[model samples]
Target: MTDDTTIEIEEVGGHRVDADRLRDLLTENARIREIFADSDVAGLRVLGPQVPVRDQDGPPFTATVVDATGNVAATVRGDLDRPDAFEVASTAVVPNPTHEELRGALEVLHADERYAPFAGRDDVIVYQPMPPTSDVEQDDGTVVRRITLGIFDPDGSPVHRFVAVDLRDRLVDWDLHGVEHLDDHDCEDHLPVGVGGLPGGDTGLGQVRVRVVKGGQELWSFTVVRPRDSAPTHLGKGSGVELRQVRYRGRLVLWQAHVPILNVLYDDGVTYRDWQNSETQFQAVGSDPVGPGWRVCSGPPATILESGTDVGNFQGVAFWYDDGELQIVSEMQAGWYRYISEWRLRDDGTIQPRFGFAGTRNPRTCMRHQHHVYWRLDFDIEGAGRDIIEQRGLILPGQPVWHRIVRETKRIRSPFAREWRVLDADSGRGYRITPGAADSSADAYGVADLWFLRYRGTELDDGVGVVGGPPSATQVKLDQYLTGESIDRTDVVVWYAGHFLHDEEHPSPHQGHVVGPELRPVRW
Candidate 1:
């Protein structure tokens, strides 16, 4: 018989037995025989009592019993031994049952409501993203440490795998799960790019090489290093790599030269697979942060203007002398356009745009600054039952400026629930403005405006103002005027309110609300 063969045969205590050609004795064909405890058949097999009796090569496993004609009848093992031990030892000797069959049997025998647990739990599953961190040295003392981002379970257990690439050697190592084993010979050279750099530098760029392999065959390849001063190359044999700094929201990041034909940005940590790239187009997904922490907000990558033509997002705005023209852009987009009612002066003798829109008809105000000048315009609006007001102010960063009223409106909307204190931008202090009454029953409301100036080479001053003196009685507490219970990033403005007192026969107009100081932008 072969080592890997299974056949039906006789067995006594798991030993093969062959007694077919011998005698027709009842005990000879018995693969398994049993004698009950203190019973009539206890000493029937006197050779060794409970010991199994059979030929060396046993017949097919079967119980034996003597009949009147001496013909041995093959009974089941259950007929000899008790059901418990017979089932256990026989189960161990046979092939394992199918999983489905075993499960079905378990379900039939142990039918309890709470027998199978974990049937309805779902909150235990969780997914989370990995955050990048600063670099450190590896234990080998040669390779530098890098932060690898990946998903994990809520209990800090790994859910996905990530590859760690060596920036210097251009090696890719796979991190596997379960088995704590390292397989270098079992790895394949699939990619050849890595992220490397110190935190701070002039040119925020890194170096990397891309290997081109076709079906285990080597193709043409190139290596390029990006530095702030030099230009990129076609291969490792270039004049070194040059890179530019990209700053966004005061954070520095590595800038990739946009290839117009491909419209793709390539970095050391980035690969073709990471981006959706075709023959003529490509799109970048939110992958990872690399290079210097700074993001470029100007030049070829981002066209942000300061004092001439406005072209930038909300994070930052700037303008430079491309040829000889001036431009102006702001982080705050113009949301309204109206007539200016008032204007304020800065500490540098520069004029700042501060005013009210066209209600109650405030006059236009103007200011002159060292680098730029501004003019405020206000319109008059008075109807029999209501008065309308509009205001706007314009600033020319340099000499001549093209003014575009990006925003013009008569209604004010805020996302917070707090009474903002209007601060004076020039004085680096807040204004002492009297808050208006929030009377929903009377349909009374208030409005105000604020303006700011950006000095050529300085930051705005930060300060707070104190409210005191005779106006204290008319002034309402900051909490009283709030429309909601929470406030954040809300603008403080000037407000005015009024109510009529009557005895159902008489009428009188009282000074509902009074103004104190104007709201303007100061240093942050």
Candidate 2:
């Protein structure tokens, strides 16, 4: 942690909460014990604490509790300053593995006799397994989660063999294809890691602060996270850089802005977008040459890039404030694919949300792929209510036209013609979104380029980021949320999906590509 970053941890109602404190609070609650009886506490998370809930004055601090066998679930939501307002839900929960939890999972395997051959090795590196090939056969494939790890051969080879460990510390015959030799353990025994808390993960909560000014007036002040604090717990691939409490020009502009749908599709039938399908490491580490050599990024960093406090573990999100536009650059390592979600907020209020794609050494390095990032922009202009989404297009060569979106629906890009804007209906203050030149349109794949829908506390990514068992990309259909909610003069969410094609004839790290949209302030 450095002075360059700002911790988003604020005291609510004179109550300071962390992961442990929240754990203690829930475990002591008589109602929780009654509802989730006879279950071991598997995990606890305080990810979304600031985002306001419906009918709430400010926001609620929410936490998820996953049971030992990963069956039962619990949720506690309360106002930040009010301790008694905590309400608990008894089921339908997913939990992110903490650093210590993953470490414990690995330690459980080491104690078993079948893994005794390499039990004493300190270099026993663990990673989320590359999803089974059978799961990739459908659009709605289920990615199997397991404690897949490799033993580092300290004498010569980096890794000689890899293995999988079930929840009971039993060894299972496993590979990229599928699992076998499980006498009792099924895929349910495979504890889901969300591909987070890998070896490079550091245990702590951190965020970077950004400030942009124009004409002697500060235009923006916000904290940047790889994915913001209240970002619906996006596993790894389905989450991107987010801006929290974004106050623009002295007014709160956005409550949160993040990408919940980040997916990479290969030419072969491989669809990667879940805990089993992604890794949250760095794209580059410790001076890996700005441009050349045997360059690649894998695993977590040796340093804690985000400053402030510690609650859980997150990796690959740091930024150094530039004299020009605030460069809130966010990079996430996803096994072979590296994603950079950058938010360039300039002094002039031009916010360019850019996403870049690079490659690492992997089986599919040369394979053609499409990287889609669906950014859910929560524009709280003036306030959450009285906000509207308008479609901008050109009537003639230079003539412009605007079409106000009234209902929740999906829209396509009209290349250089069509653009979009989200603004306060009462006032004209808003931001216009224009896709980048390199951002290709969505293909025949079952996904739209743009979507506008009414805001809801439960509408974040189909609640599939953290998984109890296997995860489903087919379940990540953002269109499922477009169930005819009115979008006129009310709280709304604008989901802009960016498409980047990795179809270069000679694609490599040297040929890195950046794609996203530029959000310029309109008539603010």
Candidate 3:
């Protein structure tokens, strides 16, 4: 006999006997002696056991047996020493099963009496089994395979049972039932995308790259660095501020640029506050913040302007509109007062930024106060270099009816109103920064309508403070950046300040009020 020709026994009673143990048992059994008496079965080697093929209606303990000479002896379908029931047979070959056939056999085991409790139930969903383990190769080049699957129910939502299959021999290794539930977080790996309880698409623009923690969100950076061949790229260092609603005195307060307003309309007949039948309704462009560290309103395309000219039934020129707006609001003292700020992106590519102090006054403290609003604008027109500031305004000479236009092209050493424009000749794009509509005391603090300075690292002020108070140290540093760097063509930033004086004696009307500045593009 060849070394490869060996005897193999199939498992019975869901358990396999050790090869040495089975050999000893067979040698001592009288029934095996009767079966192999006519054959030369001495000095035979033993091979590993094969898993038994389950019969549909046979007794549960039945299994097939083979002799030491690799010959099928007989079917063991009784409670004998398992190997004793084998009678001599002619065939010796048993083919290995495929993965699919093994999986089907395991399913049968799942429906059998062993796993009858979980055989059928509602509200129990079964996920597909994971990929099989890596193939285990034998010396003869045959492969062994195994796979495991979890059974889950809704309560506690953990997997308590598992099905393990031995695919090579086409047998169910174990149908584990009533075992201790293990936290199978790995089961979520099998879930379909967007169907599992995962966060979908709740991100904002300028947030392409961010480090997020649960519960709160922050603004890490606002600048996007795109490098030119000869110019050094601007590396974006985050502003180091929280981007979501702020906590002021234990209440959540949103900045002006963080409030989301759907639309701002100026219709022919309706007022700007009218929500119904307004001619112009602006749209938001996702959830990107309008300014640094603040959320802005975005949706629907803006209806910037509309006009038509007709000559006796023949229409002439027609104008439609497209633009954007950012509106934010903050409530103080339980809605007793609401501070609102509105910024408009004009159709002609200019920005109209403004703010207002309105709402009812608290009866407890009807003291007089004023609101000073300021804005910090960083201009990057035509690659940030060689820009000149020009102040041009119409001045009346000593009460004469005729007004003389004064135009001065120079750096702003001090703060004053002159209808300033920061122009870059190379790009031919400039911005005309001026104060918007105000109540009365817009320039009460002697600050200019606009201030210009070279771009510096830590100079930012929004001008929100007490009316008659001194400027903070930050404001003083802003002045220091303007000591006189040649702004003729270098990178620059503009600071525009506006204000509203509110006295309790002259309270705001039920409708409220608005204020700020208007910035228009010059020679773009």
Candidate 4:
């Protein structure tokens, strides 16, 4: 040994040294060499004892040291491999890769440092896999069943169960669709909630801090500041209308509605009334004033019409001078109503129904089609003088169809466009008429086929919009119709069976005379 304190030579100048002293010198040299190698750049030289072999080599000594720049200076050992170890020690201080880059490369493996001790002594290094726990339970006591993340181990078993975390609540929950895992920092305090740690002892699994917001029975809930600690702000505003559930991008939004009218377009001043409210308030509706839409009408005790009651009380009447006689046409529960009586025009020009049925069925009431009775008058009437009645035919429960038949008049218009003749004419060629466009002279003088189809429509009180869809004719514009202005549209709905679309060539249906809101079908 070179140092006097480490010298154990009993006989100097070719004498044996003490084994303990030699061992002590070698250990000191190794420590000094390692420190110097870590700090050096250019190099320095170190001297130490080398392992002795029985059949040995030329020299039996080792030396390793480094320069100031952390570069290996030189190594003089009997074995050449000793220099390589010295070089590795010197080059160990290379620049460290960024944490982000390292994490990217190792995230899949869950290669995160559980314990990184001071450098040089790495015996206590520990690594943990990502997503450290599974079988997480929710506040409602339901176990999370799905996860969108995967787990991995470092040494032995590489697979482990992980639970999805609720970001809002900061709680771990299982999800089958995705594997859920945590960042290294979040796993610090998190403990394994399930079984199976290491075999010998409890694995030093850490715990994670999670502030979970408990769930409630409400459809929608969010955090809100209350007088005390923060509380949940529920979306359901007192539950006027209870819905099983609703979603917006898979998130529930609960709201309440109590008023009958729901204003959809406050900017445009448009609103919608609930169907229930409309039904309750207006049990009976009548022809649209301002042209041809149905108006809520209440008369004859405005309740739902009973089986044998008069719907006539719900409608209006139109009068005309017919062959020096006064005539009236209207509708009631019994169907259509028509009244005719001799007229003596008073000098004062006052008009009245003289000795006529309060309400009577109009010309066409029942039709024998395929030997089946189809109620076609269950519809609404509209326009100047209400045209044909339109209705949704639901006689067959399984299938709903639409039907419109023109009401034949005692005096019907001629197809030739020349004149009006008796409906029971020489040929009874029941002509079709369409509400003429106000500006078109040709149509103003006579009706057209296309206009007839457009003018009549059958709609039912379906929950949404109209059951049979919008009327055939372009619906009377809201602005024009509401303002009492005439638009090109002139479709009317009325209550009459088979009077909606009549074929003069086909035999007429059972026509009837005016009685009272009751139909007394008469074969014409």
Candidate 5:
């Protein structure tokens, strides 16, 4: 080991030179070394320290280094703040390989005999950092990172193979389909085994697990079950929507396409709901082996005609119209019931949440029932503190329907029957929850539109029924949070309930029906 106190300087070309010391200094500082290496520079030569005595607590020292051609390369600055610190800072251009270069490299890799089967086939190749796992242990202090190139067939079949690279060692590993482990020491041997699919049958969907690793430690992991149909649902070919984690307006915005809770009450005194909790009865999206019934829909974006003015379109914009709608559909009761849940993200930062039931009615004739769908929105608005809820109601005068927006806002200290808004004072951003389209008849509680309550971590007992349990249960945990606790400038949760009544007179459409609320942003 080189002593930190020793300073070596070699006079080269009549100029004091210390190339080895400069390289050692650059390598000791991780950030500066990364910049130097990434810049594709050949080598660096230290000219000399700015000060004669090499003061330990003096200002930063500047040294000039020459590139491979012996020409002046860069002027590096080193801060001698600590006796053992050799921190270097420099301005160097680290040019990343272009997409064409990456594609060319993939083409060359596909030419290998191991990847020949996937060559010349229309495929989707995704590159991502492999997470940390026990399979690859890094004991040498060399930061071991892996990048995975997942290759999928043209029809969006399962990932054909995972081509990985050990960045630190510059080694390559490939797991090809139908091939056993090529090497006994392969990382595949130590990879974590994920749940294949539904316990009993194939769901036509496949699972892909990726781990995000940093410094040989797993930081995060994600598992994505391949959809039966890869195309967007709005195209009408499928109903599976890909919910992406996005950062909107400097805030992390994530969405879940399906909410497991769906309650169906029949007029014949039977209720069906707890499918999510039932191990034997729970069916995943593509569980139906024969002609997978579940589908996701990315509905065509429609123009928002609010207040008779054509606001910017919802979903995403194109040339003429916008594209919207994120939907998922799954069947239960052996195709007797098809449940469709949809979430539409608008360009205006509003979310339109809706779900409905369709498919053939049950064998029981004259089946009149109501479907209540509840959503659990765990909002961490502006970092999740000091949030308040307010209810707004329209006060209509006698025979006078105010054309203008006539609504009252009140702090919700307890469970309230009105439209609500969750506001964050720090960010000045708020969300208003309103009911979707509903029938003229009033609900069982007379307030079918929405409900407001504080957040109790354990509100849902076992995910048996909706958040509020059955109507008969006295302690409806959903309303239990509304114990008159002041929700003013406090962390709270607002639960919105929406229902659709299916009667013998008018049945659900052959396709299905959609109903839910529009979550609009207030002063965001």
Candidate 6:
């Protein structure tokens, strides 16, 4: 709740599938083991396949397995084309540097005498450069894995330079940008609200049950699945906040709603997502280079006071009421930015959903970019029946025009057509969505703002690849899901994108940057 009254928060034991055990099988598979070539399998990440039904025991799932430390990835399935009943994968995919692998990159630099000024410092921040660049790498016999790492040194350290070092040490390239590295905490007090990966660790299996009540009446309820980091939405299935059995007052609204992917496009044409290089701890990597092409701090700079808040809940659900609404919130860190998934419901059945974009520390913090969050809203209306969707157009004459979405397709918001509604055709009860003021239109990389499609088990996400893959992977590619399906009178899922701009110039950054929509009750 944005503003709230008396609220209560608690956690209940819940398990949809044995994700951990399933991952174990994938890791132990003979064929999969060979792919890694016995690299120290130091850490592994698997994004579970799309599991449409939140409840129902052990549905067969195919998970995308990532061995970041080992530099390879694959897909694992319970049932495959083979009779052995399962398949490890068809081919091995290269993944980005792991949290540990990033640390190893730091060591690579320390060994060189030129970088001796900051030798043996564990606080160095390291991460892949953002977008098109992060994805750009030479696939030659000598694979080039470009990396950036630097930290603020008050004594004016030599941290403002771009260095490309071949692991073999034969090719160490440097391009310096002389930005002063002041050892100060000037920007520490401006830490943004809602840091991600709150109460971090083993996210794939974490789920929190929440119930919102006000003045003795149940208003909203659901389960929050803190999903694992994915290679990209396309390769994996489960990630982002999954709200199950969402209810308003005593009636059903959305069966499920969650973020399939949040794409950020910078002025430099670098695209980032919620699943790429996600933060698993207190600090996440920041964007844009601070000085030159270097600046390292694994989490936020040590100077930032509030970036290190203890993430509570070793295992369950938690909640609390605030101001005038009942707010159920969760956080996740993708590199330097924190994604805050908040669902707020007031006593009057008014719903205000928001996704926050907050930063830690980095040179790119001042760079102009756009944060677009895609939410898969699976609407049940009164019950999972043939429902209808509609959009409101500009006020023509004295009346605002309303057009019902007749087919499965993607949509872009405009001043003329700015709102939409989904309803139970028979009963005619539904909700209206008013876009956030900051929610911008489609950008060069962010194709469109919304996709109103008929419900399909296989269409959970646009499946845009994000792990620094091919040039094609960087695109939202939601158009693939538009292969015409009727939505005239059927269960529908509305994918809404909240596009917020992060500019260091205009619009006071100190005020805060949060973007989302307000779903007001249309008619009960």
Backbone clash pairs for candidate 2 read: 13-81, 200-300, 205-310
Residue 359's C-alpha lDDT in candidate 6? 56
lDDT of 5 by residue, 21-98 (tens): 655656555655564553334344343333211134244444444332212134455454442565444432111112
Worst 10 residues of 2 by lDDT: 182-191
Off by over 4 Å in 3: 1-337, 359-365, 395-416, 439-448, 462-477, 508-512
- Rank order (by lDDT, best first): 6, 2, 5, 3, 4, 1
Residue 167's lDDT in candidate 1: 30
TM-score of each: 0.15, 0.69, 0.35, 0.13, 0.41, 0.74
Compared with the true structure, all predictions reach lDDT values of 0.20, 0.55, 0.33, 0.21, 0.37, 0.56
lDDT of 4 by residue, 214-287 (tens): 12222112111110100000100010111111121122211110111110111112111111110011123433
The runs of at least 3 residues in candidate 4 whose Cα sits more than 4 Å from the true structure, single-residue gaps closed, are 1-428, 437-524
> What's the lDDT for candidate 6?
0.56
- Give the per-residue lDDT digits (tens) of candidate 3, residues 78-197: 333565554433322222222343345456556556556655665343322221122244696444444444344445234324555554355554543322222333211122111011
lDDT of 6 at 209: 53
Candidate 2 lDDT over residue span 195-214, tens digit each? 23444433333344555544
lDDT of 6 at 294: 17
Model 6 per-residue lDDT tens digits across residues 1-524: 33233333344455233556565555556776676655443345655544435333243455666654334567665643242466666434444334444455556765777768655554443333332112223455323444444343324443223354344343334552222223323232232222111233433334445566665666777665554532123254234556767777768888877777777666665555546224333322333122211112223222112244423222211233455565554455554465566566676777777676665554555667777777778889888867898898777797748888888887788876799999889888888888887677877567888888877766666655444433245557777778688898898888888778876667545324667778887787
The candidate with the higher TM-score, 3 or 4, is: 3
- Candidate 5 residue 318 C-alpha distance from true site, Å: 20
Q: What lDDT score goes with residue 26 in model 1?
A: 28
lDDT (C-alpha) at residue 380 in model 5: 47
Model 1's C-alpha root-mean-square deviation from the true structure amounts to 38.4
Residue 49, candidate 6: alpha-carbon lDDT:
48
Give all candidate RMSDs, comma-separated.
38.4, 9.0, 33.4, 43.8, 23.5, 8.3
- Ten-residue region with minimum lDDT total, candidate 1: 273-282
Query: Per-residue alpha-carbon lDDT of model 1 for 325-426, expressed as tens digits?
Result: 111111111100111111122222121222111101001011110000111111001101111112222433563322211121222222221122222223
